[model samples]
Target: MSVQHPKESWLIGDQGYPLESWLLTPVGAPNTSKEQKYNRLHGSARNCIERAFGVLKSRFRCLLKHRVLHYSHETSALVVSTCVILHNIMTKAGIMLNEVEDEVAEDFDSPNNAVDSSQYIREGERTRSRYISTL
Candidate 1:
């Protein structure tokens, strides 16, 4: 459920984060039904993001919490961005990273390959419904 923008990706955040064009956040106290649904979808998306962080840390040791990045703030951010980009490329190609030497496996699929439209819709609806019930 990544938001596609002209220059960058859509980033979903919680209430504490500042609102920006690229940043989709939930309303603290949703009044309208539409706002409530938006909150549910935003919450569901954030759940996916949190799970992605877990997977990212597991796949890349540099992102592990125990390892402190001694780089400057901007440099550290760049390092993280680089790692995430690599992770996305590897995942798209179905490349499993077991060890340093294992990363050179044959690529399976292209990142731009088409996938089932319904599968994505069903998954999104399921995620949203699951989030709705928990509220």
Candidate 2:
């Protein structure tokens, strides 16, 4: 598998292992200028997502603090999904998202106003973060 992928390729992030990243090649290698440009562009886009997650995780204290009410799993799913949708709507409307901290705000990229990958990931994992749910 390594031989087929070659060390020269960059590993795109799958759903698992948020901290683990692999670059196929060393930081710099001889690639076509267009390829290099595209790689940089992709990296920048990915970084924007990272920034968004960083913001969402920090702002949504409830998500970090796990609390499970006695609702059925399916209903719980709906509730969580609704919260996420509302969060996105609030963010888009530029309403204050519960000020977390200046450091976290700084962590976010300039609001190119892009959404994050967490929104698209499997709903279960989307609710889990480095912070544990308090509930």
Candidate 3:
């Protein structure tokens, strides 16, 4: 079940994801001043996803403790989905996350994974260029 978005709306993705009409990605090698500015804004906006994952892991200690989910792929997906639903429900009920006095430093570095963009290369480039022009 995919969430419906308006035609003008877009989902922000990092460099690892392919760009589409509904998805926006930053320019790899921005040349112009406007392009550079657009990339900065895009990156800032995309950081929300990272922060969200960090919060999720911090809240659900089991996910952080188990580097690799022992369960099958389908089971792991369901577990994650249930965790997300519980998190939302807890948040809505005004339950605060437990605070850790001794905060452990977390490495939130993004992996440099090469994603296949051959199919959407042209379309992605066009979309990026059009958005950059508006900036």
Q: Best candidate per lDDT, number? A: 3
Residue 57 in candidate 3, Cα distance off native in Å: 1.2
In model 3, the clashing pairs are none
- Tell me which of candidates 2 and 3 scores higher on TM-score: 3
Residue 4 error, candidate 3, Å: 8.1
lDDT of 2 by residue, 17-109 (tens): 232223211112214554345435545656665666556666665544364445787786786677678778988998765443322122222
Q: Over the stretch 1-135, how does candidate 1's per-residue lDDT look in tens digits?
A: 564666434566555444445554455455667657776666666666677777677788888878989999889999999989999899899987543221221111221222335554344334434444556
Per-candidate TM equals: 0.52, 0.37, 0.64
Give residue 110's lDDT in candidate 3 (0 to 100). 38
Please provide, for model 3 over 52-112, each residue's C-alpha lDDT reduced to its tens digit, 9 standing for 90 to 100: 6667787886678667679987898998888899999999999878644332222113323
Off by over 4 Å in 1: 1-10, 88-135
The count of residue-pair clashes in candidate 2 stands at 7
